[model samples]
Target: MTFPAPIDPPARLLMGPGPISAYPSVLRAMSAPLVGQYDPFMTATMNETQSLYRDVFATANDATVLIDGTSRAGIEAAITSLVRPGEKVLVPVFGRFGHLLAEIAERALADVHTIEVEWGQVFTPSAIEEAITRVKPTLLALVQGDTSTTMCQPLEEIGEICRRHGVLFYTDATASLGGNDFEADAWGLDAATAGLQKCLGGPSGSAPLTLSDRAVEVVRSRSRIEAGIREEGDASADDFVRSNYFDLGMVLDYWGPRRLNHHTEATSMLYGARECARVLLLEGRNAVIERHRRIGDAMLAGVRGLGLDVFGDVAHKMTNVVAVEIPDGVAGDAARQAMLTDFGIEIGTSFGPLHGRVWRIGTMGYNARPDAVFSTLAALEHVLRRFGARVPVGGGVDAAAEALT
Candidate 1:
């Protein structure tokens, strides 16, 4: 049963939660020839990648580095290494990814305490502070933006609250990093993790992470050195990190001047991640963030022009994504499928309780362009019309174009 190796060039609109339109420069960087892991050039490339990510993460920590694998890998590395079993951790669940943080902590055998809000709303800093006061959690785990409901949880106040409570604050910024503002040091974020796939305009294989000195101390105390790498009578030989692969302790050593080997580094993905951060830095993080804001505004106005109601409190919507309420009697999945199959556009749907009830449209990464904003709007309007939903022809695109202009 031989299958035809047909041309796999799929039509290219990416208005989704993640993997949103990789930058052409990033793709080119990935295609560059790979070098040996210990090659001088490769070592330099690793250093440069870490430096670039430091700027993107807005952190001065020397430990800022990339974790190979997806965003969840970064989450696992940050949590498993920093949180010892029985350490109390507070997690506030605003959406799906908050649940993910709780799950990771539980797997690490952390004493986890969680406070959940309704899907679309965010927990106030005071609410989280109260929880922290009650639980006396040593680590506070949360997601900056949960793409499931297109909500950007307020972080600034929460970070300060955690500081007062003596809680090390950690965040998963996978869906929000490049498109939104984050200050690792200024916000008192002890540790933070993000994936390159979302707003970073790169592939999903690398997760960028930055840890404050306090967070680093936690990792250092729990660290265990593997036997093979240890020297006889070495003072640090006994500190074997709990999870060998996801150990930030070893990862930092590998990324540091020691340049030790943990695994075969994902060279191509590192190149891609480096280039992604380079592009973001060149554009200026604040400008890139503003671009996402403008595109999201255009997309939101376009969705409204199509006679659809947007979900969530508009005041708190994430800068890179929007959640639109699927109108009554309109088949959300069918319209999404039609838009994908017929028009070659990909918009995302919601998750958890809002699944099938809302459409999560992304204006992020390379797809935050004006063309993508209008094309997605126009395609969505056409698909909704086919489903007998009364969307005004040309109105959506016109509105988007107006905003984009």
Candidate 2:
């Protein structure tokens, strides 16, 4: 395949699972010249980044930070560091990402137990309480939102249950953090991980994480000092963790005043993550969440106006994204292809049992705008009609306008 010299593509809307529209400021931050990994100025910026992300995460924990990889890295770091081998971890499976938590726990040699829920629904506080009581797990790992089926799991009530049972509650907020209302400390979440690509309006290369004092204790108990960093007079520490790279003890030491070397911190990605949190904090967390809520509601109304059935529990739907059923007589693949090729729009298809039955539409981060919502609906209306799906002319746009207003 031959590629032409760079030419800018037309501004097409992104309404997919992730890597949604990034803010111009974040892009510009990435383009700035790089500095040495251990530069004093870089460390100062890193400290500031942590401070900004603390506000974004709504936590006062000093351990709040950005990991060098994508959202999954944050999850792995949190899991591998917090869950020691032979410890029981209770996971309630509702979507694909819950399966991810189970798999990661299994890799960690954890005694994993699962409470399965039906697709398109979430677990109740009582259900999780029963699981925790039965398993007596040391850790509870769950996802705040699973994009595979467009389901947002209720976390506040579940967190309280974990707290009561003396279980360390951990969550992957990759798809929901900045898009919804999350109170890390108030809700009793021991640790939470997120990606920059979702509602933060940044690239996917950075993962932000926060941990409470309970989580810090877990890490401190398992911490291990690096061999290279040892000195003649220094004695070995038993609290050292197994994995050198993912060790939060090492990371915290490096991030703290010690200024030791860990990974050659992704300098530009740090800038991007910093700006992402700064932008969200500047907008105010509640206001940012409200913006996503308004736009998501508009998108839902637009889909309904197009005569399509919205999937999942509408009452518990996430503020950042939505799921809609593929109407009868129209090929889901054909409609999606038309939306991509003709309208330059990108949406998502579901997985597992919902495969070929639902279309996932997202209104997240920089794309959460009234104009973006209307444009996507208008394009989808035309595409649906073109595929023999019955849709009233301008109905989707009209409904979305009313909802946005």
Candidate 3:
């Protein structure tokens, strides 16, 4: 049987919601030679990655480590390890990803309760607090940024409220971590998870996770040694984490001083994750977030200049992505495909309520730049005009340029 030639894909400027182009440094790092899982160099590299992610997550938690999977893996690890079956968990839903958290909690056999606002809006602190007070849940699970609606839920106040109520707080920061303002320790977050694919400027294979001391305690309480590493006195919890592969207790031990074997670490992905954090910290966290804000602002203004209506409550939107309403006559999917086929660019489509109504454009990771933003705006204008929508030829690029200035 004949097989295909060596894999090659087209070059594209990814101006979509996520999986944006990775930083060159991160790509280079992934090509480094593989090392043994317990080699001195490998363990040291793991330790260094942990320290770097702590800085990136804005936390001092000693249990900070990378999960050897995508961002959703981090979320499931945090949820499955922290909440035993039938434990009450509260999820505040504002978008598709918020509903995702609730769904994951339910699959963990959690007694999940959810309070929701409209798709394009975020829940206020008071609303979340009211639900928390009524439910008296053991954990508050939420999403920091839900790209489906291009909304960022303000977490500082909600974190405070969760702390006062003695609830363990966890958030999925996959789409917003490096590009937005997030304070795991200061915001009273007990557990937080993020992916390298979005704002971290790397591929989607690694997930950086951090756990506060309180969250660590919760996971440790459910600790159970794997059969391969069992000792004479080892004891398992009455309700061990359902998924062995995602058990934070075992993962923590492997990442911790014990170095107990869990799984052979994905060495290349770990290198990429390390470089992603290094690039962010070297540039300074605040400066990277500021870059996202500036570019995101330009993207937003550019879309508006094309006579497009922006979706959601603009005041609480995320810094990395924006949702623009689809024009009356333009076919949403067809326009996006044209942008890809004709221009070698990619833009995002929405889900759930926003589907068929809005397009999600992103300026994030390595592509969060003046050139990328301007190029996307220019392409969008051409596509809109070709689709029979009225748009000024140079309006999008001109507005974006002005915003950058």
Identify the candidate with maximal TM-score.
3
> How much is the lDDT of residue 373 in candidate 2?
87
Q: Which stretches in model 1 have alpha-carbon errors above 4 Å?
A: 1-7, 226-241
Per-candidate Cα lDDT values, in order, are 0.87, 0.88, 0.92
- 2 or 3, which is superior by TM-score? 3
Of candidates 3 and 1, the better by lDDT: 3
Q: Candidate 2, residues 81-151: lDDT per residue as tens digits?
A: 99888889999998899999999888878899999988889988888898899999999999998888778
Q: How many backbone clashes does candidate 1 have?
A: 6
Tell me the TM-score of model 1.
0.95
Worst 10 residues of 1 by lDDT: 231-240
Judged by whole-model lDDT over C-alpha atoms, candidate 2 comes out at: 0.88
Q: Estimate each model's TM-score.
A: 0.95, 0.94, 0.97
Better of 2 and 3 by lDDT: 3
Tens digits of per-residue lDDT, candidate 1, 1-405, equal: 998898687866888888788999999999999999999999999999888888888889888898999999999999998887788999999898988999999998889999998888898888988899999998999999999989898888887888787889999999999998888878889999999888998888899999999988887776555334453344443244557799887888888898877788999998999999999999999999999999999999899888889888788889899999998898889988998999888888877799999988898898888888878887888888888888888989988888877
Where model 2 places Cα greater than 4 Å from the true spot, the runs are: 1-11, 226-240
